[model samples]
Target: MVEIEKRNSILEVGAGGGYLLNHAMQRKKKNAQYIATDLTEAMIKVMCQRSNLEALKIFYAGINLFLLMKLKIL
Candidate 1:
């Protein structure tokens, strides 16, 4: 397990059902900023509803991998 000394901004692309997102929230780092997004809308809905997840910040969006050469998230 990697210890997070400084909870920097995070962006999770292609986050499926947010299983990892739930785990990330458990850390509860004060400076943590989280963003979880998926390619499927249905999956995102289920994750938000069924998971009952809590985080500092969560973002949902569809990404086209072909168009994305490199992503710089801040």
Candidate 2:
């Protein structure tokens, strides 16, 4: 489990519909920043439509092979 503190910045990758992030936001400090990213526009749209997650910063992004190589994750 991740421990969130005040003023912390949370980044959730591949956050489809933001189910977990939404739940985490309920318990997180108000000053904390939550950012969610997903590869698919459909999932991002779904998260955007969720009224409970209006405070979240949503983006469309994906990790490609080039990034993996650059990060030495491949």
The lDDT leader among the candidates is: 2
The residue-by-residue lDDT of candidate 1 on 16-71, one tens digit each, is: 76677656666636556666766566666666665654323334374332111111
- Candidate 1 pairs with clashing backbones: none
Q: What is the lDDT of residue 6 in candidate 1?
A: 49
List RMSD in Å for every model shown: 8.3, 10.1
The parts of candidate 1 lying over 4 Å away from their true place are: 1-5, 53-74
Q: In model 1, how large is the Cα lDDT of residue 10?
A: 59
**19 Cα displacement, candidate 1 (Å):** 0.7
Q: lDDT scores for all predictions?
A: 0.53, 0.54
* lDDT tens digits, residue span 1-74, model 2: 77764536677777777677556667666666666666665676677666333423333374321100001111
* Deviation of model 2 at 10, angstroms: 0.3
lDDT, residue 63, candidate 2: 35
lDDT (C-alpha) at residue 4 in model 2: 64
Question: Model 2 off-target regions past 4 Å?
Answer: 5-7, 52-74
